[model samples]
Structures are given as structure tokens and as C-alpha cells.
Target: ELTNRSFEDPPGSSVTPSGWYDCGFEGETPPDILPSPTLNIGKTAYHRSTYLGLTVRDNNTWESISQELRQPMQKGACYQLEVYLARAHSYWGISRITGKEANYKEPALLRIFGGFDGCDGRQLLAETPTVSHTDWRRYVLQLEPALKPYDHLILEAHYGDGPMPGPNNGNVLVDSLSNLIPVDCNANPGLNKNPEPEFAKRQMLSPKEADRDLPLPVSEAAKGEPISETQLLELITTTAPRIAFDPAGNLEHSHYTDPLTNKGKWANLLLKNILDGLAQHPLAILVIVIPEKDPNLAALKKQNLKEALVDLGALQEQVILRDWLEKDVEKVWYGNAESGVLMRLIR
Candidate 1:
């Protein structure tokens, strides 16, 4: 294992542990040890005690911590490098260039490079997709030096080129880095370059061609000849009424009673709309689908909403409450609008 692999020794602000050199831009801050307990950020280090934290700034500048391998990598040998990564959801610091307060939450990525030079060679080895989650996750990179031997490895953290707009500055945490370990490459044929040729040939269908070979789409399969007028009328009569409310709206408040008059007005407007729908379809069922993770919290919201509806003359038995997982709803509803409760007519 690499020396000081955990980065637990000689710890202090902007300090790089022994055996690792801070090769980032001059005058810029190097990776530092994150304090334990990571308060207020809602994350914990993958390993107990301290972890390494690196930053990337608005101008696209980044930081890195590197080390020269104690021994040169053997050519044609398979190695596996593993590291744990997490995003710093929120960070507050002053930019060295602008000297302004930099508060942002952006994604950070880990790129591993191996080369002949000390740590500055340009050969790319392996890179991870952006590490954007606040929770710690492990990433592994398989390395097989085909020809030239590499003497150094550099670990970099920086922003990815994603179109989604976000704060330009961000931080990422690195912890529990494992040394590149040699594995039995022959035992794992998939990891080795010598996989059976027949196996590769079996998976050769292009995506477009494979999609063309699939059965008819679900929408087409469900489609049938047009219905008669009597059948359509019966279908219309059996369909239930629905109304939707924004999940982020005033109804999400923890309190049952509206603290502000404007909130009460908004609640009343939603209740009035639901009541009108119920009146037009007196025999139809009233189903309320709220997008929430917690069933208990959703039930509470339903109870509060029902009470508001009761004030508007809606009977308790006429309403049904349900909680739809947000992911399931997103699969069906493609609207870019903000999250909300979706009440829909159903049979």
C-alpha cells in the first residue's frame, strides 16, 4: 500500500501528508483534511476521523494531490485502484483570485492519470463520471499497462462539463484510497483483454437495430378500434375526478392551520377547485395523489386537505388519498413544472 494512504498523519489546514505532494496551481490551496463529523453538510466520511477535501473554482481551475509510486508499474499487469468519493453539497470560502465570498454547490469528478514524468505527464489512464451525490460511494478503475511503465499517479478533483447550470465553484471529498493491487487477471476473463471471441460476437447488435427488433410499443399494443358512443359515455361516467396542487406550495407547511392569510387563501382556492370538480361528477370518485416519500406525512397532508375540503362542503367518504412515489410519477408525467400533488381522473 502507498505510504500515508489514509492521509491521517501530519494533519493541519492546507496540509498534504507525507509521501504525497500537492501539485496544484501555485498560491492556490492544496487538498486539506476534512474535520470529523462534517457538521451542517449532512454527510459523513467513508472512513472515520479525517478525509481529504479538494476544491475547484469558478474559472475552471482545480486542485490535485499526487504521489510517485514506490515501485514502477509492471507492464501487462492488471491492477485495480479504488477510492471513495462524495460531493460537498455546500461550501463557503473566499476565492483567492477574486477575494469574494464563494458559496456554491457543484459536482466534482475524480480523474486518475499515470505517466512517466514525475506527475505532469499528459497520458490519460482512467476517469470517473462526475461524483455529484452527497452520500459516499466507491469508484474503481482497472489499470493494465499495455506497453510503457508508469512511475507516478495523480488524483485530480474538478468540475465536469455538464450543461446543467449550477454554481461554478464546488468541493469534493476523497477518502479511504486503496493502493493499486494486482489481481489474477486470468481468473476474471471480463477484466482481462483475452475474453472469448464468441462472447463478444454475441453482443454485437447495434442499438438502433436492436430497438427495431423489439415488439410493438406499449401505446400501440393498447390501441384498439374506436369505441361506440354508448361505450364512450359509460367510460366517461365511470372516470373519477382529479385536481393537482404544487408540493412546494403552502400546503407543505408543518402546521395544520395557515399562519399567513395569503397561505389560507391559496389553500381555499385549491379546495374550491376540488369541490367544483366533485360537484360536476357527483357519482365519480375523488382521488388525490400527493408526491411524497413518507406515507405517514402524506397521510397527514391528506387529512389536513380533507379538513379544508370539508369546510367547503365536501363529504369525507367521497375522497380517497394516495401517495405516489416521485420517481414513478416522473416516468408518466414529463412536465418540467415543479413537483406537486397530481389528482387525476381514474376508473
Candidate 2:
């Protein structure tokens, strides 16, 4: 079970709240317990009156809030972790001189890390892409701790590689954290089995009605054979190849020399296809991979993709954004620049 899931108790404080502790940053300030609906931030917590607020600095320093679980999470158990997160969209840190809010556009970011030792021995579990939304959005991740039981979780906020810093600061708000719930991995509900119910009913159509209503399948690719629905479902429910976007933020064409007329359009179509697949596979989790090179550029691309998905009505919690180190990228898809977002379905 989780305590203070909404950060509601110990009322009206800007310091640490009850049942949670500030995970220090060694010579930096601790996280704050702030009123969510304040005039400055202008948003309420997903659940209650208050939420945890954290900041990232220009020097790359950040802050974190952590809690020790009521019971240890069992090893190898599949558990769902959910939280509501939002970026300030515009916030300069608490002013030292005037104590007033300064306006800025630095993107607020949050990463979830789990561990056996109190906020130490942690491994990067899941994180959001550049959080630019002022509204609170839910984010979910399925955690299967492999080697040991984890009793602690940390939520760290930082300035992602994008967004120029003002007085070296950015902020993120967090609320409504959920306790881990074990999932029955083998159970495939009929709802999931029939991904598109309305389309499935099309079989009831008379041949004449079908001919009039259903459009013929049009293949777009020039060479590859079409995949079966079963294959498509498998691809949606299982892990996929790492997709890398163009480093220069060009979603339109694979290369500058490529004679593609609708590069951007194709990129949007690819994203829409992935979103459609996820909608069919409700249990599937979406993860966005961000490369380490040029954090600012990576952050911007991540934010843009996330915004596009959000516009398509994807829940913030159902998707995860993670950063990839240069070495990690090379290990998988080496020398590919035009690749777009990579996705993996949670097992």
C-alpha cells in the first residue's frame, strides 16, 4: 500500500508533507509541499488540496520526493504504478530576492526510480517526456522488479534537455500516486480479444451492404506483404524495434536527399498507427525513448510527440518517456538517424 497518495495531509505547508520525506540532492534544496491551486501555479492537484512540487536548476541539479512502501513489493511480481503529473509550463524558481514567481518556459520533467535501499540502489523505472502541460495528467508503468523486493520509490523532477533556463529553474507538480497492484498476465479479456468492436460487427453486413459501406483495403507500401490481424495484434502487444526520430527534429523526410513529398505527414501517420494499435491493446503500455545526444533537441522532439499523442486523446499515464544514453542507442539501432519514436508493450 502507499501512504499519502494524494499529498493531502499535514495541511498548508511548502515543506515536506506527512508520510513522505525529502530525498536530498547533496548541497541543494529539498522538494516542497505546495498548494496546487495557488495563483502562481494556477492548477489543482489531481485528487486533493495539495501536491508535491520539485525543481531543476541550470547546473543540472534537481530535487526528489520519496516514500517507503508499507510492505515490500514482491520480486518478479507484475505491479502497476500510477501517478498524476503536470509541468508548470511557466515558472521561475522561488525568488531569493523578492520571493515572487518569475516567468519561464523550461520544461518540467519527472522520472520514477525504485529501489531496495531507501531511495538508494535505485534503477530508472519510468519517466515522462518533457512535461509541458499545465493540466494534471495521469502516467502509468508496470513494474516487475527482477532481482529483489523494492520498498521505496522516488519521484525526481528536473529540467529536461530542452527549454532555456531562467535563473536556472523549472518545476513539476505531482499527485495521486497509486499503490502497486498485481496483474494476472495470462488473463486475456474478450474486450482485448476483439480490439475493434464496431468493425467486428461489420461481418453481419449483407454482401451488398458491405460493398456499399466498407472500403476496400488499400496497401500503401511498395513491396512488403501485408500482416494478418493476429500478427498486428502481436506486434501491438509485444515489444517493438527501437524507433529513432531524426536528430534534427525533421519528421518529414528520412534524409535531406530523400525525395519524400510528405515526410511530416508520413511521420504523423506512423504515430497515429501506433496510437491506434495501443487503443486496441488496452493493457499495452507505451514508452517513448529519448536519445542522450543534445538534450535540448531531444527534449523538444519528445515534447512535440507527446503533445501530438495527447491531442489524439491518449492518457498521460498510459504512456512513458525515457532517455537513452548514446552507448545504449548504438547497441541497438546503430547509424540510424531518420528513425522516429520507439515503443514497447509492457509484459
Best candidate, TM-score-wise?
1
lDDT of 2 by residue, 1-347 (tens): 77777777633334676787777667666666655334255444444356777777655567787788888767766666666666766554554445566554467777777776566746665566666766665565556566678789777886665657443567777876767767653442331212211211222223554442333222221113455445544544331222333223322211111133432221233344455555554565666675546666677567656655664567666677667655544443322233445554562
TM-score of each prediction: 0.50, 0.48
**lDDT tens digits, residues 1-347, model 1?**
47666566533456676778887887777776765332234343444346777778776678887788989777777787667677777666676558898664677777777776655845555677777777665565666766678888888876765443333677777876767878765644553332211110112233543442222122111133344433433332322111222221213111123333434222334344344445545465555565555565466456555655655567656666655655655443311122335454433
The lDDT for every candidate, in the order shown, is 0.55, 0.55
- The whole-model C-alpha lDDT of candidate 1 against the native structure comes to 0.55
Model 1 alpha-carbon drift over 4 Å, by segment: 10-12, 36-43, 161-167, 184-347
* Candidate 2 lDDT trough over 10 residues, lowest sum: 191-200
In model 2, which regions exceed 4 Å deviation? Answer: 10-14, 36-39, 94-105, 165-168, 184-347
- Candidate 1: minimum summed lDDT over ten consecutive residues — where? 194-203
